[model samples]
Target: MQITASTVSLTVDDVAASRAFLTTHLGYTVQAAADGFASLTRTDAVDIVLLARGTEVLPPEQRDQHATGLILAFTLDGGLQDQEKRLRDAGVEITMPLREEPWGERLFQITDPNGVIIQFVEWVTPDDV
Candidate 1:
Protein backbone atom coordinates (compact mmCIF):
# COMPACT_ATOMS: atom_id res chain seq x y z
CA MET A 1 0.00 0.00 0.00
CA GLN A 2 1.23 3.49 -0.79
CA ILE A 3 0.51 5.81 2.10
CA THR A 4 1.06 9.48 1.36
CA ALA A 5 0.39 11.07 4.73
CA SER A 6 -0.66 10.49 8.31
CA THR A 7 -3.25 11.92 10.59
CA VAL A 8 -4.41 11.47 14.19
CA SER A 9 -8.09 11.68 14.97
CA LEU A 10 -9.04 12.62 18.49
CA THR A 11 -12.45 12.35 20.07
CA VAL A 12 -12.74 15.39 22.27
CA ASP A 13 -15.41 16.84 24.50
CA ASP A 14 -14.92 20.24 22.87
CA VAL A 15 -13.72 20.20 19.32
CA ALA A 16 -13.41 23.96 19.25
CA ALA A 17 -11.20 24.02 22.30
CA SER A 18 -8.83 21.44 20.91
CA ARG A 19 -8.88 23.08 17.53
CA ALA A 20 -8.04 26.46 18.98
CA PHE A 21 -5.21 25.05 21.07
CA LEU A 22 -3.63 23.36 18.09
CA THR A 23 -3.91 26.42 15.91
CA THR A 24 -2.91 29.00 18.49
CA HIS A 25 -0.14 27.21 20.32
CA LEU A 26 1.01 24.30 18.19
CA GLY A 27 1.42 26.08 14.86
CA TYR A 28 -1.46 24.33 13.14
CA THR A 29 -3.86 25.90 10.69
CA VAL A 30 -7.46 24.96 10.22
CA GLN A 31 -7.74 23.19 6.92
CA ALA A 32 -11.44 22.76 7.39
CA ALA A 33 -14.02 22.98 10.17
CA ALA A 34 -17.68 22.62 10.95
CA ASP A 35 -20.01 22.43 13.92
CA GLY A 36 -18.50 19.30 15.43
CA PHE A 37 -15.33 18.70 13.48
CA ALA A 38 -12.06 20.39 12.61
CA SER A 39 -9.10 19.39 10.49
CA LEU A 40 -5.79 20.97 11.39
CA THR A 41 -2.51 20.92 9.57
CA ARG A 42 1.08 21.87 10.27
CA THR A 43 3.72 21.78 7.60
CA ASP A 44 6.17 19.79 9.65
CA ALA A 45 3.85 17.76 11.86
CA VAL A 46 1.15 15.20 11.56
CA ASP A 47 -2.31 16.39 10.67
CA ILE A 48 -4.84 16.35 13.51
CA VAL A 49 -8.56 15.86 13.26
CA LEU A 50 -10.72 16.80 16.21
CA LEU A 51 -14.15 15.28 16.41
CA ALA A 52 -16.63 16.16 19.09
CA ARG A 53 -17.49 13.23 21.30
CA GLY A 54 -20.64 11.43 20.28
CA THR A 55 -20.52 12.94 16.82
CA GLU A 56 -22.61 10.95 14.43
CA VAL A 57 -19.83 10.57 11.93
CA LEU A 58 -18.09 8.16 14.23
CA PRO A 59 -19.00 4.51 14.41
CA PRO A 60 -21.63 3.72 17.04
CA GLU A 61 -19.19 1.74 19.13
CA GLN A 62 -16.57 4.53 19.03
CA ARG A 63 -18.83 7.53 19.49
CA ASP A 64 -18.94 7.17 23.23
CA GLN A 65 -15.20 6.82 23.59
CA HIS A 66 -13.00 9.82 24.30
CA ALA A 67 -9.33 10.13 23.55
CA THR A 68 -7.33 9.13 26.58
CA GLY A 69 -4.08 7.51 27.67
CA LEU A 70 -2.41 8.67 24.49
CA ILE A 71 0.58 10.89 23.95
CA LEU A 72 1.09 12.71 20.62
CA ALA A 73 4.81 12.79 20.49
CA PHE A 74 7.09 14.69 18.10
CA THR A 75 10.70 13.80 17.72
CA LEU A 76 13.08 16.67 16.96
CA ASP A 77 16.44 16.41 15.39
CA GLY A 78 17.77 19.09 17.75
CA GLY A 79 16.77 22.24 19.67
CA LEU A 80 14.83 20.36 22.31
CA GLN A 81 15.83 22.89 24.97
CA ASP A 82 14.99 25.84 22.78
CA GLN A 83 11.58 24.46 21.97
CA GLU A 84 10.85 23.80 25.63
CA LYS A 85 11.89 27.32 26.54
CA ARG A 86 9.72 28.80 23.80
CA LEU A 87 6.70 26.86 25.02
CA ARG A 88 7.32 27.91 28.62
CA ASP A 89 7.67 31.51 27.61
CA ALA A 90 4.40 31.27 25.77
CA GLY A 91 2.69 30.34 29.07
CA VAL A 92 2.27 26.66 28.27
CA GLU A 93 2.40 24.62 31.47
CA ILE A 94 4.96 21.87 31.38
CA THR A 95 3.27 18.84 32.86
CA MET A 96 6.52 16.90 32.56
CA PRO A 97 9.63 18.95 32.91
CA LEU A 98 12.45 18.42 30.46
CA ARG A 99 14.58 15.54 31.59
CA GLU A 100 17.19 13.28 30.07
CA GLU A 101 17.30 9.56 30.50
CA PRO A 102 20.34 7.37 30.88
CA TRP A 103 19.61 5.84 27.52
CA GLY A 104 20.29 9.20 25.79
CA GLU A 105 16.72 10.32 25.36
CA ARG A 106 15.50 13.74 26.41
CA LEU A 107 11.82 14.56 26.57
CA PHE A 108 9.14 16.82 28.01
CA GLN A 109 5.37 16.74 27.97
CA ILE A 110 2.42 19.11 28.03
CA THR A 111 -1.30 18.49 28.33
CA ASP A 112 -3.81 20.29 26.16
CA PRO A 113 -7.20 21.52 27.32
CA ASN A 114 -8.81 18.21 26.40
CA GLY A 115 -6.23 16.28 28.42
CA VAL A 116 -4.26 15.08 25.40
CA ILE A 117 -0.62 14.71 26.24
CA ILE A 118 1.88 16.15 23.74
CA GLN A 119 5.45 15.07 24.12
CA PHE A 120 8.58 16.49 22.49
CA VAL A 121 11.54 14.16 22.39
CA GLU A 122 15.15 14.37 21.28
CA TRP A 123 17.69 11.63 21.19
CA VAL A 124 21.05 12.58 22.58
CA THR A 125 22.67 9.74 20.71
CA PRO A 126 21.54 7.73 17.72
CA ASP A 127 19.45 4.72 18.61
CA ASP A 128 21.61 1.61 18.72
CA VAL A 129 18.78 -0.84 18.34
Candidate 2:
Protein backbone atom coordinates (compact mmCIF):
# COMPACT_ATOMS: atom_id res chain seq x y z
CA MET A 1 0.00 0.00 0.00
CA GLN A 2 1.07 3.54 -0.56
CA ILE A 3 1.50 5.63 2.54
CA THR A 4 1.74 9.36 2.12
CA ALA A 5 1.90 10.32 5.78
CA SER A 6 1.53 8.91 9.26
CA THR A 7 -0.45 9.78 12.35
CA VAL A 8 -0.95 8.38 15.81
CA SER A 9 -4.30 8.80 17.48
CA LEU A 10 -4.28 9.03 21.24
CA THR A 11 -7.32 8.74 23.45
CA VAL A 12 -6.73 11.04 26.39
CA ASP A 13 -8.62 12.07 29.50
CA ASP A 14 -8.24 15.70 28.53
CA VAL A 15 -7.92 16.33 24.81
CA ALA A 16 -7.24 20.01 25.18
CA ALA A 17 -4.44 19.43 27.63
CA SER A 18 -2.66 17.02 25.32
CA ARG A 19 -3.31 19.31 22.40
CA ALA A 20 -1.80 22.24 24.22
CA PHE A 21 1.22 20.23 25.27
CA LEU A 22 1.98 19.20 21.70
CA THR A 23 1.59 22.75 20.47
CA THR A 24 3.54 24.37 23.27
CA HIS A 25 6.34 21.88 23.89
CA LEU A 26 6.58 19.70 20.80
CA GLY A 27 6.18 22.26 18.03
CA TYR A 28 2.90 20.92 16.71
CA THR A 29 0.37 23.10 14.99
CA VAL A 30 -3.35 22.55 15.15
CA GLN A 31 -4.65 21.35 11.82
CA ALA A 32 -8.16 20.97 13.16
CA ALA A 33 -10.00 20.82 16.46
CA ALA A 34 -13.39 20.56 18.10
CA ASP A 35 -14.77 20.12 21.58
CA GLY A 36 -13.40 16.62 21.98
CA PHE A 37 -10.94 16.17 19.10
CA ALA A 38 -7.79 17.79 17.82
CA SER A 39 -5.46 17.06 14.89
CA LEU A 40 -1.92 18.31 15.25
CA THR A 41 0.84 18.47 12.67
CA ARG A 42 4.53 19.32 12.43
CA THR A 43 6.73 19.42 9.37
CA ASP A 44 9.40 17.14 10.79
CA ALA A 45 7.33 14.79 12.92
CA VAL A 46 4.45 12.44 12.85
CA ASP A 47 0.95 13.87 13.00
CA ILE A 48 -0.92 13.41 16.26
CA VAL A 49 -4.64 13.21 16.82
CA LEU A 50 -6.01 13.71 20.32
CA LEU A 51 -9.45 12.41 21.16
CA ALA A 52 -11.18 12.75 24.48
CA ARG A 53 -11.81 9.52 26.25
CA GLY A 54 -15.29 8.27 25.43
CA THR A 55 -15.42 10.29 22.27
CA GLU A 56 -18.37 9.14 20.22
CA VAL A 57 -16.36 9.01 17.04
CA LEU A 58 -14.85 5.79 18.25
CA PRO A 59 -16.66 2.48 18.21
CA PRO A 60 -18.79 1.92 21.31
CA GLU A 61 -16.45 -0.73 22.62
CA GLN A 62 -13.35 1.44 22.04
CA ARG A 63 -14.73 4.78 23.09
CA ASP A 64 -13.65 4.45 26.70
CA GLN A 65 -10.13 3.25 25.98
CA HIS A 66 -7.17 5.52 26.72
CA ALA A 67 -3.74 5.33 25.15
CA THR A 68 -1.23 3.53 27.36
CA GLY A 69 1.85 1.37 27.14
CA LEU A 70 2.96 3.17 24.04
CA ILE A 71 5.99 5.31 23.42
CA LEU A 72 5.85 7.81 20.59
CA ALA A 73 9.46 7.87 19.53
CA PHE A 74 11.23 10.15 17.11
CA THR A 75 14.57 9.13 15.66
CA LEU A 76 16.80 12.07 14.91
CA ASP A 77 19.92 12.31 12.78
CA GLY A 78 21.92 14.28 15.38
CA GLY A 79 21.84 17.00 18.05
CA LEU A 80 19.87 14.90 20.52
CA GLN A 81 21.73 16.41 23.45
CA ASP A 82 20.86 19.91 22.38
CA GLN A 83 17.21 18.99 22.03
CA GLU A 84 17.18 17.42 25.48
CA LYS A 85 18.79 20.49 26.99
CA ARG A 86 16.26 22.77 25.30
CA LEU A 87 13.41 20.74 26.68
CA ARG A 88 14.89 20.85 30.17
CA ASP A 89 15.42 24.59 29.94
CA ALA A 90 11.75 24.99 29.07
CA GLY A 91 10.76 23.37 32.35
CA VAL A 92 9.78 20.09 30.75
CA GLU A 93 10.49 17.31 33.20
CA ILE A 94 12.47 14.43 31.82
CA THR A 95 10.73 11.22 32.71
CA MET A 96 13.83 9.27 31.62
CA PRO A 97 17.19 10.95 31.80
CA LEU A 98 19.33 10.94 28.69
CA ARG A 99 21.48 7.86 28.48
CA GLU A 100 23.60 6.17 25.84
CA GLU A 101 23.66 2.47 25.27
CA PRO A 102 26.66 0.30 24.37
CA TRP A 103 25.17 -0.08 20.92
CA GLY A 104 25.54 3.66 20.34
CA GLU A 105 21.89 4.57 20.80
CA ARG A 106 21.11 7.61 22.92
CA LEU A 107 17.62 8.29 24.14
CA PHE A 108 15.46 10.15 26.63
CA GLN A 109 11.79 10.39 27.37
CA ILE A 110 9.14 12.73 28.65
CA THR A 111 5.55 12.13 29.51
CA ASP A 112 2.88 14.36 28.14
CA PRO A 113 0.05 15.74 30.26
CA ASN A 114 -2.13 12.77 29.39
CA GLY A 115 0.66 10.33 30.20
CA VAL A 116 1.79 9.58 26.67
CA ILE A 117 5.48 8.80 26.59
CA ILE A 118 7.43 10.80 24.04
CA GLN A 119 10.93 9.53 23.42
CA PHE A 120 13.74 11.01 21.36
CA VAL A 121 16.49 8.78 20.01
CA GLU A 122 19.72 9.12 18.10
CA TRP A 123 21.92 6.33 16.86
CA VAL A 124 25.64 6.29 16.22
CA THR A 125 28.23 3.86 14.98
CA PRO A 126 29.71 1.91 17.88
CA ASP A 127 33.36 1.26 17.20
CA ASP A 128 33.20 -2.02 19.09
CA VAL A 129 29.95 -3.14 17.58
Candidate 3:
Protein backbone atom coordinates (compact mmCIF):
# COMPACT_ATOMS: atom_id res chain seq x y z
CA MET A 1 0.00 0.00 0.00
CA GLN A 2 1.17 3.49 -0.79
CA ILE A 3 1.16 5.81 2.16
CA THR A 4 0.23 9.29 1.06
CA ALA A 5 1.04 10.99 4.34
CA SER A 6 1.87 10.40 7.98
CA THR A 7 0.51 11.67 11.27
CA VAL A 8 1.35 11.31 14.94
CA SER A 9 -1.37 11.69 17.53
CA LEU A 10 -0.30 12.81 20.96
CA THR A 11 -2.44 12.83 24.06
CA VAL A 12 -1.53 15.76 26.26
CA ASP A 13 -2.87 17.32 29.42
CA ASP A 14 -3.46 20.57 27.57
CA VAL A 15 -4.22 20.45 23.87
CA ALA A 16 -4.21 24.20 23.46
CA ALA A 17 -0.85 24.55 25.11
CA SER A 18 0.76 21.97 22.83
CA ARG A 19 -1.06 23.38 19.81
CA ALA A 20 0.17 26.89 20.54
CA PHE A 21 3.71 25.71 21.16
CA LEU A 22 3.88 23.83 17.84
CA THR A 23 2.38 26.60 15.76
CA THR A 24 4.24 29.42 17.46
CA HIS A 25 7.61 27.77 17.69
CA LEU A 26 7.77 24.90 15.23
CA GLY A 27 6.19 26.39 12.09
CA TYR A 28 3.10 24.21 12.17
CA THR A 29 -0.21 25.48 10.85
CA VAL A 30 -3.58 24.53 12.20
CA GLN A 31 -5.34 22.10 9.91
CA ALA A 32 -8.31 21.83 12.25
CA ALA A 33 -9.15 22.38 15.89
CA ALA A 34 -11.92 22.16 18.47
CA ASP A 35 -12.38 22.30 22.22
CA GLY A 36 -10.00 19.44 22.95
CA PHE A 37 -8.41 18.54 19.63
CA ALA A 38 -6.07 20.12 17.12
CA SER A 39 -4.55 18.90 13.86
CA LEU A 40 -1.32 20.64 12.99
CA THR A 41 0.58 20.41 9.71
CA ARG A 42 3.75 21.53 8.02
CA THR A 43 5.00 21.07 4.48
CA ASP A 44 8.36 19.74 5.54
CA ALA A 45 7.30 17.70 8.51
CA VAL A 46 4.89 15.03 9.60
CA ASP A 47 1.38 16.05 10.66
CA ILE A 48 0.73 16.28 14.40
CA VAL A 49 -2.60 15.77 16.10
CA LEU A 50 -2.96 17.02 19.64
CA LEU A 51 -5.69 15.40 21.67
CA ALA A 52 -6.44 16.37 25.22
CA ARG A 53 -6.01 13.50 27.60
CA GLY A 54 -9.32 11.90 28.41
CA THR A 55 -10.88 13.00 25.12
CA GLU A 56 -13.51 10.52 24.16
CA VAL A 57 -12.48 10.52 20.53
CA LEU A 58 -9.67 8.21 21.54
CA PRO A 59 -10.16 4.55 22.24
CA PRO A 60 -11.32 3.91 25.82
CA GLU A 61 -8.09 2.17 26.69
CA GLN A 62 -5.94 5.03 25.34
CA ARG A 63 -7.97 8.10 26.25
CA ASP A 64 -6.37 8.48 29.64
CA GLN A 65 -2.82 7.85 28.53
CA HIS A 66 -0.46 10.80 28.29
CA ALA A 67 2.27 11.13 25.68
CA THR A 68 5.55 10.20 27.26
CA GLY A 69 8.92 8.60 26.51
CA LEU A 70 8.69 9.70 22.92
CA ILE A 71 10.87 12.00 20.92
CA LEU A 72 9.43 13.54 17.79
CA ALA A 73 12.57 13.66 15.72
CA PHE A 74 13.02 15.42 12.39
CA THR A 75 16.01 15.09 10.13
CA LEU A 76 16.80 18.28 8.23
CA ASP A 77 18.48 18.84 4.91
CA GLY A 78 20.77 21.49 6.37
CA GLY A 79 21.07 24.58 8.60
CA LEU A 80 20.89 22.71 11.89
CA GLN A 81 22.99 25.34 13.64
CA ASP A 82 21.01 28.30 12.34
CA GLN A 83 17.77 26.66 13.36
CA GLU A 84 19.04 26.11 16.88
CA LYS A 85 20.23 29.71 17.04
CA ARG A 86 16.89 31.00 15.86
CA LEU A 87 15.05 28.93 18.44
CA ARG A 88 17.39 30.19 21.14
CA ASP A 89 16.79 33.76 20.00
CA ALA A 90 13.10 33.17 20.38
CA GLY A 91 13.68 32.27 24.04
CA VAL A 92 13.14 28.54 23.50
CA GLU A 93 15.14 26.57 26.00
CA ILE A 94 17.28 23.96 24.30
CA THR A 95 16.73 20.90 26.45
CA MET A 96 19.59 19.14 24.68
CA PRO A 97 22.42 21.33 23.56
CA LEU A 98 23.49 20.95 19.94
CA ARG A 99 26.14 18.28 19.70
CA GLU A 100 27.79 16.23 16.98
CA GLU A 101 28.48 12.55 17.18
CA PRO A 102 31.41 10.54 15.79
CA TRP A 103 29.08 9.10 13.17
CA GLY A 104 28.52 12.57 11.67
CA GLU A 105 25.14 13.07 13.28
CA ARG A 106 24.40 16.46 14.80
CA LEU A 107 21.29 16.98 16.89
CA PHE A 108 19.56 19.07 19.53
CA GLN A 109 16.28 18.95 21.37
CA ILE A 110 13.62 21.11 22.98
CA THR A 111 10.59 20.26 25.07
CA ASP A 112 7.19 21.62 24.15
CA PRO A 113 4.76 23.00 26.69
CA ASN A 114 3.20 19.60 27.22
CA GLY A 115 6.61 18.04 27.79
CA VAL A 116 6.84 16.50 24.32
CA ILE A 117 10.44 16.12 23.33
CA ILE A 118 11.16 17.49 19.86
CA GLN A 119 14.52 16.79 18.34
CA PHE A 120 16.20 18.13 15.19
CA VAL A 121 19.00 16.28 13.46
CA GLU A 122 21.38 16.76 10.55
CA TRP A 123 24.17 14.65 9.19
CA VAL A 124 27.51 16.02 8.06
CA THR A 125 29.58 14.89 5.10
CA PRO A 126 32.31 12.33 5.66
CA ASP A 127 34.93 14.97 4.94
CA ASP A 128 33.51 17.19 7.65
CA VAL A 129 33.18 14.40 10.18
Q: Which candidate should be chosen as best, given TM-score against the real structure? A: 2
Model 2 lDDT tens row, 55-126: 898999989999999999999999999999999999999999999888998999999999999999999887
Question: Where does candidate 2 stray beyond 4 Å?
Answer: none
Q: Write the per-residue lDDT of candidate 3 for residues 85-118, one digit (tens) a residue.
A: 9999999999999998878889999999989999
Two-way lDDT contest, 1 vs 3, winner: 3
Alpha-carbon lDDT of model 1? 0.92
* Ten residues in sequence with the least summed lDDT for candidate 1: 120-129
Q: Report the C-alpha lDDT of model 1 over 5-108, residue by residue, as the tens digit.
A: 89999999999998888888889999999998999998899999999999999999999899999999999999999989998999989999999887889999
Instruction: Sort by lDDT, best first.
Output: 3, 2, 1
For model 1, the superposed segments whose C-alpha errors exceed 4 Å read: 126-129
* Residues forming the 10-long window of minimal summed lDDT in candidate 3: 120-129
lDDT of 2: 0.93
Can you give the TM-score per candidate against the true fold?
Answer: 0.93, 0.95, 0.94
- Cα lDDT of all candidates, in order? 0.92, 0.93, 0.94
RMSD of each: 2.0, 1.0, 1.6
Alpha carbon lDDT at 52, candidate 3:
93
